[model samples]
Target: MTDTIPNPESEGPSGGWGSVKSIARILGDDKPSPMVLEELARQNKPGGVMCVSCAWPKPANYHPFEFCENGAKATISDLTSARCTPGFWSDHTVQSLRGWKDYDLEQTGRLTHPLRYDEASDRYVEVSWDQAFDDIGQTLKSLPRESVVFYSSGHAGLEASYLYALLARTYGNNNLPQSSNMCHETTSVGLQKVIGSPVGTVVWEDLEKADAFFFFGQNPGSNSPRFLHPLQEAKKRGAKIVTFNPVVEQGLVSFVNPQSPVDMLTGRETQISDEYLQVKAGGDIAAILGLCKVVVEADDAAVSTGAARVLDIAFIDEHTVGLESFIDLVRSTDWSVIEKESGLTETAIRGAGELYIQAERVIGVYGMGLTQHSQGALNVAMVVNLLLLRGNIGREGAGCCPVRGHSNVQGQRTVGIAEKAKLIPMDKLKALFDFDPPTEDGVTIVDAVKGMMSGQIKATISLGGNLVRAVPDQKAMEEAWASQDLTVVVSTKLNRSHLFPGKKAYILPCLSRLERDEQASGPQSVTTEDSFSHISGSVGKRTPASKHLKSELAIVTSIAKATVAPNPKLKWDEWTADYSLVRDLIEATYPDQFGAYNERMFEPSGFYRGNSAHDRVWKTEEKKAVFTTPKQLNALSFDDAEGRLRLITMRSNDQFNTTIYGYSDRFRGIEGTRDVLLMCREDIRSAGLSEGQEVKLVSDFNDGVRRELAGLKVREHNLPRGTIGAYYPEANVLIAIDHHDELSKTPASKAVPVRIEA
Candidate 1:
């Protein structure tokens, strides 16, 4: 085995002309800039604000170029003149449309109006908004409260998300699963349990001032390119940036800032990570544990010898609990176990730890790589423990930062969207809206599929997102969806989820964040929260693709009014009329925190929803941040079977969540394909496979059912010996419904045991 994999020679620093080329392609494919100049002008004419792509906090002083390449693609895709009209649907049957790729389906165009699937004709026909809402209302009234569930996407605004949650509860159901369940549920659950906060404590400004940053399980280059700016600035300022992952991401390798003309023109690049360690899949716990062990040993040695202290004794003693027990677990853990699990030598772990020991201020940032595991929650908690050792929390340029991949995932949760009832009490709802909310736990994504399988949940309403394409065990999920009595999707474009029709299904078109949403009062502005808990306003400027399309808030209010009628106190109509009123209600529900929601939202930089952990004010039962001792290190174990390997699912640079932007992942040097499996050369040879050889992958699971995907091409890469990588949604088939984080129910998409056959 080699100590380091050879870096590709063909690769160049990110954001040279490559970003311009990609953006041009996106604009060219959807609508040439010249052709859609009017649409672009309409979208940014006046009083228009905020980038529609991501929830990254904006600067206090706004600029015309606040958007990024990805943001441009997202905006162009939304405002595309191409239309998926009734004629287009008539020409392409549902079965026929299924053959088109996810990107092609979306590229076909913006959904023009509400549509309903007609089984007889095998096509979707246009329907009046009134008729669609009538059907949704009737179906909700027909089913038992427990049998009806509402799902939300992270792209939704705070006002709409709040209304959706309120509507679901007032209608007597708490099955409000969201896209966050698949991504950042671990952050919410783990942080809340440990520090009495469910969101990241550090803001964007902290990254600029940090002395060091540890990035784990996240690829900022492809996932969020805007992040590259701050990372590059930190690197230029001499901050040590360390990365841990199974694959080396180019964006983290080197970035030539596109925003900086000098760097782009001169080919000057800023190297991002100081050291990149390729940890095994699900090996984050072991790796962090080993690093912590090194730091603790050095600190203990220093204290016993009466040397200067390495650990922050005062901070730990005053602000944390369970330290002695946590220290015992880390100290007593054998090095051999850590070595075997982490796929890193003791020297490597200690080398990384030395940075922590030397740094005056440190910030830790991670993505799904830490959260998409069976022990995902434990992974988050362990990171918190690492920071606590040095008084990292409650300080500038230092704290825990879980890079929420989605735009407003943190905000969606804050607006009271949850599966568990105890988390959001019924009493709070009763006082705020004068309605008795449900008081029982509801089904999450996996459980919702189970309910459908058992003939319990008969209907579903998705605020946004491609649920069928996003969940695990696609075959089972598709079967479960097929058995539903009714399914309704509120969306802006057509995707794979709409293809899986229940007995009665409807695709209701809604205005996107980039389009002007005119309510009864006037053009509406909605608020979204960033990963750092800053809530800012997003006011679209373009006209709706179709006049018939309704706003998400309006759709929710209309449905609520029709289904849960005779309730005047709820004021669903008023909330839709003026979004500020919705903010007022949110303020009432969370008085101390959202007390000034409306005023703060309009502030140029937005305002932070104070995190107790940021101020060292732990609100836990112990009145201090608690150190959690996980039961074990890694939750996955591969069989001794010869060809067995740990397989992890990931997104390409061309994709966002389940939305496939294209077939190429420019960062990984992969072009024109998503069917390729990245594996170490040794592993490929051991499996009797050559680079570019076609093979079949079968997942190993406790369930008797066999889940396999064939015709996958093997590609030699720098992954760990026993680990392989594949794009998600396509590889989601390998993940079993039962394989998820127990605490948060997040699917272990990053680690799955499997076998490959030539």
Candidate 2:
């Protein structure tokens, strides 16, 4: 039997009954019994807690219904009553289950026991935690420090990340490959170079006060649903919302506030984007430079005509450097190059610039779309450059806002999870943990992949995440994982990565973020940082899916004790007992920002890790926010055969990172399937192809390796000409791991020139 694919809707409100129906479907399907449903409801109620989904800071005055549809799905996904037993694994061989889809694997429910792969039986059998830890410890201890790498997922809490960092450094290995290496490494590198901080300067509340919002490569409706509320509010208050993306996302086009009873009942929708510029894939850098060019030219006219200057001359003179060079580059850039590279007319670019000039305060928001390209760092710098010109930084309702997709990705980085050992000062580790940390830099996700192929990575300890599936070049990633001597995955649910075992592999089931974590002290709370650097405490109410499941803190502590020779001064055991102690230690490590950790942790309003750029306090070497003079925008070349299209990998509404919730993408009108590639009708005709035609896509690579994805159905889309959009992870196979950004090492997943085959 074949699956039926639904047609894409031409128009609809972002969220209303669609969100409600989705919530019902997920929760009802996952937890059928009345008793289970009641328990799930109890877990979702607001009682001074945080949402388990994306890390947008909860307001000081909490609403009873604070969670969004995605949050509900994420929470219920963890609240699932189903459990995978040892008997279940015995019935299915690893090779047999290899045919399962990502959603199918997640639907198998929580991992109920610690299991180790047995070569003789070709199956995973239940094992004691001590036995698993012992094997892992012995293997790790035997290997040279450089041979082992610690890869962390962003799903874990701050406490676990801090402990994991300590464990890695103490074991004399600093090779920590993190999820950030895949997602926002460019944001960190690019923003840090200019503002001395990688994170966004604007707070959550600033959105309400902004006069205009320029969303670049972000769809708040899907990636971060909580943000839609703020955008809706900003729209209601007469703020201009401009969008620049390859695809016209439903969330950015129009939205019906699910929180509003009147809007929900009447189907009254609020138009989101006043201007939607559909830039070509990998064209964001050129588009932003073009906008800067308009602003610079406008400022020049304002100076001559005695009009109010668009550029912030006072702020530029006092708080920035290299403005002249930046303006010169923008001026010298050709109009034809901007138009061709951006896939937008000069009139449109200039019009958006006019909107910027008209507004007193503006916020710039972007996502992975800008940072998943070869020129990702330059793309980020361009956004910063645009905002810097108008004095968007150092003011309320105006700053660069990078929407962090994961719930705790930013928090993990805040609490000592970094590839660079020096990112967390040695003095802090020495004073707090009393250990002389390794000075050598650690490997990132990209580095780990290269290391694995060369047999440099002997063992791997993963905290959470489907690491193999998330990386590009799927076949290569799987082959590399098979070469490891020991691979340990500390996880809650079953994923594709667990099936591909090393010579010795162990699956250590851990408590989900939605489950209550009780320890020696009492119910524990973990902290997470939002995209805007607001830190809040989240405590789950649901009972553990399995009594055998351990908290991440406990898992890390046990591993640290078994592997690293115990130091009386380290206090790993004590830290596990009460997470507040961990927060206290974290505060001790960074006393200035995290002072009074316990008190701040309980703050209903949460604590803000202040940004120097927002306050006009530059920490740069020049003692000011540096105006980066990027090279002039070059005319983009697809360099592919005439009928070829540039493909940009995208996420479905039902997906978050590699976690597939359902088959449908409600926003894009894709239902019941992820096998379709969205293409422009003209491109389809140009290639002499028809809609619903099955074809193979062969990626053009610089490495001379043939990477082809077969059996992809083409569907007509409203995409810009010469570009196509396909679901991520599935399309990730086309991205060559070696084809990555030079500065950030992030795979160029957003831009892949491909030729269609019959």
Candidate 3:
């Protein structure tokens, strides 16, 4: 046994002297001080660099050093002094590098030059950009456009993603699957069905107008620490915050803002969540359903007594459809079933719902915890249903806020990075590019992985992401990834996905967000959209890491120019030389959204791309938002399997999506390891297991295929009896690739059924 101890206690309240020191250590870790310092000072400011980390919105009245520890880590990690040169490539082979950790691989640092995988030596060799681009372009042109998938990551800015989408469409395909496909695809698909919009319906300032906040399946304390400031402010102003999660999170409990002088000087901490409910993993919808029953029943009572009704009759009658069915569903649902599934009592759930009923304006916030599940769409739909009951959609400080994880993830989707052909305006595309674009539905992440496995996907052109690690079924993904004909990745630093190269693999070096991207006109400023639907400018001031490196826009343009034959209407070089042309094309493409293009984005406060749902403009068939119901409430609602547990894959304090900075999880009081399974003591006894017991996890999906992970040490936690928590990507091995939500096809990382065996 490893004898690794688990500390369920948090290190301290979120963001104190500890977070600052953590950031300091990373900045001091072989990074150039002056450049990094200057970059930090200008980060998330007017005419400043947008964080390449989380998509949390920035404040208009910014703090002097407006950044979280995670932001600093992301910046320092990318602007590293270490460089991956041709010599470094020779030092490590493809097969040898597979065993390396994700953190170690990225820590080796940025790729200095474009490189191609050599079969004979099993190594990557330096290649000129011209040859690499020509080869990749020729191969893409040779294949049927449907066989190619343009995989864009969350890191790329608006201009690059927009051009990348155009590159895919003009080359004759709609197979543009990006990061959002895996994370928030559920939110997009579900919300669009209900509200006619695929994004959230709130601005950052809306937090100020709220009397209460109901947070579910989100941990901003770790993933998006910058949000703590506003939550802190909200709590200070006596706004009630009700949180629902599987585990105790430090930020939701209390917070000590690093930027606040009083907090640092006096060691004062602000309490965050007034009511913290530890609902079972994937029971958010069930809990929400319970809440609905509470509100509807209360409304009936209020009507009889001639008091204020709990449900908003006017909004429900005029602005929504399927109201009767929704009410019927809520009334028909039994409290026994809700309590059984939600791992919460009727009294507890009603208390939380009462807070919602009392507050005039409420904000409902959620994250991947609710989205990465079998009923992920239902999870989102239920929240909307709850909000609509109180006429919350168009109200100030009261709406649905799906806090996005990575930077520009939403902007990518907004600017046409989608697999659905209908989502892309075919008429506008035909008129603008003057080419016959593919109108067929393309592969999503799940379909793409399946395609690669079955040898249908011939090529994958990634703009920036650790796809293999981010996806499920690790063993199969690696096999299918290496089996492909071509795998092209454009990135600033190396990741595990790069190690599993195809037969003809290429790692193309690109400019980081920290470096100046100068085009033919002069220096350029790229724009990124945030969780709030706000767009801001990012201008990198640091020097380029390598002279041989090219901007992502330049690389994508080269490939497109080489692949597609000369078009008299297209100006590839001109657009690549001056990004303003790309922005102009964006303007023509999304006139209402990006009008004025280059000018409005640089405004000090940025600009909010208004949400129609927020303005009470329903873009659906009947011009009204609908109340959606779950087709089937499966394993996520409850798991009754004997000797089984519901597994939720989570990130630690020192982690991002698929990127674990160190072995230690800062807030969780864990150090030097991430291979431990978190379980409540009762569950351990029930399973005939002891603390720190070495065990193997077996997937219990009843599928013919066998999936097991050995050597994970068990650690006691505060989770519900039938639920266990483990680090994401590490526990991802136990989840089958096809185990996902039916509506959105989002991999159910949060609600896998598994068992521990000694």
lDDT winner among the candidates?
A: 3
- Score each candidate by Cα lDDT: 0.82, 0.82, 0.86
The segments of candidate 2 whose C-alpha lies over 4 angstroms from its true place after superposition are 1-11, 32-48, 632-641
Candidate 3, pairs of clashing residues: none
Q: Lowest summed lDDT over 10 consecutive residues: which window, candidate 3?
A: 1-10
Cα lDDT for residue 548, model 1? 85
lDDT of 2 by residue, 602-650 (tens): 5665788778777878777788888877653521233546666788899
Q: What local lDDT score does residue 520 receive in model 3, on the 0 to 100 scale?
A: 86
TM-score of each: 0.96, 0.96, 0.97
Please provide the root mean square deviation of candidate 1 (C-alpha atoms, Å): 2.3
* Top TM-score prediction, candidate number: 3
The residue pairs in collision within model 2 are none
For candidate 2, give the lDDT of residue 609: 74
What are the clash counts of all predictions, listed in order?
Answer: 0, 0, 0
Question: In model 1, where do residues sit more than 4 Å from their true spots?
Answer: 1-6, 32-48, 61-64, 637-641
RMSD to truth, every model: 2.3, 3.5, 3.0
